[model samples]
Target: MNSANLNIRTDKDVKEQAEQIFAELGLNMTIAINLFLRTAIRKRGIPFDLLLDAPNETTIAAMEEGKRLLNDPAAPKFSDMEDLKAALDS
Candidate 1:
């Protein structure tokens, strides 16, 4: 099969970040881009969702609080469902 060079203009940091992500997924940029192109052709559209529904402020705060509680030694731990319910009731 014949191959072609595809040149693209992208921000250095963005390219580096993309490379890191692709590497983590066991793919190089060429394979990742080719997969994307083939998938796009098969789907007749972009292969992934473009609309990103990021966590709202309330959700972010709750997640941060959950993490803090997880790391806290003083955070209560219940041995079972009844114990958990008892703690909640107290």
Candidate 2:
């Protein structure tokens, strides 16, 4: 694959932090960046989610409720894929 130069300017503190992380992962900054670019090209999305944090309490509660409902023994069961598909079509 062809490649070109990508120049970015970051604060020294940020660069130092990134270098430490890359070192821990056994990769230099260049390799890490190349992997990121390759993955972004392949997936057409950012290499990582980059979320600041997980869902907050309200969102977590709603997700847990949904999971409970799905796994409840008393929940109705569809016979097969076709039945589920039919239900969706209806």
Candidate 3:
């Protein structure tokens, strides 16, 4: 099959990072872009989910609680796995 050039402009850092990742996975930019395009055509949409990973309020509260517990002087500390198990059982 005859091949054609596909030109796309992206940030220098983004291009470098993506190229590095593709190289590690035994792919180059052309192969990676073609794979993406072919997959998108086959799936009729983006092949991967595009979701914001922002933490929810409940998750944020839990993380804050964990930080507080870590800093608390009275928080119980276990020296070993057996001690932790014994504390949990009590």
For all predicted structures, in order, the TM-scores are 0.54, 0.52, 0.58
* Model 3 error, position 33 (Å): 0.2
Encode model 2's per-residue lDDT on 7-87: one tens digit a residue: 999999999999999999999989989998989999999877777877999999999988997899997568899998888
Which numbered prediction scores highest in lDDT against the true structure?
A: 3
Instruction: Give the higher-TM-score candidate: 2 or 3.
Output: 3
Q: Write down the RMSD of all candidates, one decimal each.
A: 12.7, 14.3, 10.5
Off by over 4 Å in 1: 52-90
Q: Write the number of the candidate with greater lDDT, choosing between 1 and 2.
A: 1
Report model 3's TM-score to 2 decimal places: 0.58
Off by over 4 Å in 2: 1-3, 50-55, 58-90
Candidate 2, poorest ten consecutive residues by summed lDDT: 45-54
Q: Of the candidates numbered 1 and 3, which has the greater lDDT value? A: 3
Prediction 3 global C-alpha lDDT = 0.96
Expressed as tens digits, the lDDT of each residue in 1-88 for candidate 3 is: 9999988999999999999999999999999999999999999999999998999999999999989988998998788999999999
Clashing residue pairs, backbone N/CA/C < 3 A, model 1: none
> Model 3, stretches more than 4 Å misplaced?
57-90
Predictions in order: lDDT: 0.94, 0.91, 0.96
